[model samples]
Target: MEFKICEVLRVKRLGKKFYEIYVKYEEEPEPGTFAMVWLPDFEAIPLSFAGWTNGIARFLVKVVGPTTAALYNATKVGISKPLGRRAPIPLSTPTYVAGGVGVAPFLYMKEKWGGKILYGARTKEEIPKFIKEEIDEIATEDGSIGFKGNVVDMFFTKPKTRDVYVCGPYPMIEYFRKRAKEIGNIKAYFSTERPVKCGIGICGACTINGKLLCKEPWILMS
Candidate 1:
């Protein structure tokens, strides 16, 4: 449940009010698992692993509130991420649908499990360059990058038959849920960006439907 910071690789600024911090974990946490990051004099928050290799873990953090602000401003701190439910890897080819920071976990998945990735962001500047190079396809809400319009919109144009894995805003996930029904053979995994005060599900901050988002993620079939 506890992890030491092996190294802080890079902290890059993305667009406005966003940063992607790459921290190497002492041990590699499983893909899709999140870590509870501890900041001095502040509450710990759950962050999904963006990518990991050679005892390293990366996280794409958006500075939204006090907890995240403390992390972004802190020079060095102890962090721990208790492993959580890991989505099963598809038996067939996997197509990733990611929007904004929701693309974080998929970025890690792309590294371990080679597959087609479709990433979308609000604008061209908000997109991460590293993700662009790795993904097989990309789309944007604005015409500034990749395809013009929402990432989900592109899905309607060239509907994929492969097993689908997606994470993003609720609207996007809800849309995919409906689309998946029309286009069967698609399995989807989604995560809600709820405030998880206690990573262990004690505080009950992260709950979706009747399931706990951190412990039991909803898996939809279409």
Candidate 2:
């Protein structure tokens, strides 16, 4: 629960509303761990670690609220380590399914295991050009991209049978959960988000079905 006021190394706007903020924070956070990021007078919000290089931590931030918008407007920010639990990384690399900004947490996995990305957005314009994956499968609602439906649609036709890691809206998690039941050998790890008022295990607001996302590594549903 240590906090540091880190210098902002770089900031790049992704698409229209999303941003990539690279901070000079000396924390070796495991993939899927979130940081409690904040500005001087703003509320701290949890942002997943997108990637890290040369002692700098990368965060993919979407401008959704006042706190996030305030973060977008700052050059330096506060970051804390391991706010959330580490996501489960399979012994054999897992298939990454990201809905919108959910793709943030999995960006670093590409470097580690050279995995493929199945990312979904509303349209092609929403896709970030910064992402350079070997096999990036995209799904958009309007058919402006790779597939005309959701990432689950891509999963049904061609089930890879490997472990699958998913992040995004709760409905997307449920969709994959149901699909996992139908399919025989898909191991789905859902990184769910609750109203995490406090990044640490102190606050009980982040509990989902009696399981705290801040304390649990992964929420797996058979």
Highest lDDT: give the candidate number.
Answer: 2
Residue 107 error for model 2, in Å?
A: 0.6
Question: Total clashing residue pairs per candidate?
Answer: 4, 0
Model 2 RMSD in angstroms: 1.8
lDDT score for residue 31 of model 2: 78
The Cα error of candidate 1 at residue 15, in Å, is: 3.4
Worst 10 residues of 1 by lDDT: 213-222
Per-residue lDDT of 156 in model 1: 64
lDDT of 1: 0.73
lDDT at position 152, candidate 1: 76
**lDDT of every model, 2 decimals:** 0.73, 0.77
Q: After superposition, how far is residue 217 of candidate 1 from its true place, in Å?
A: 4.0
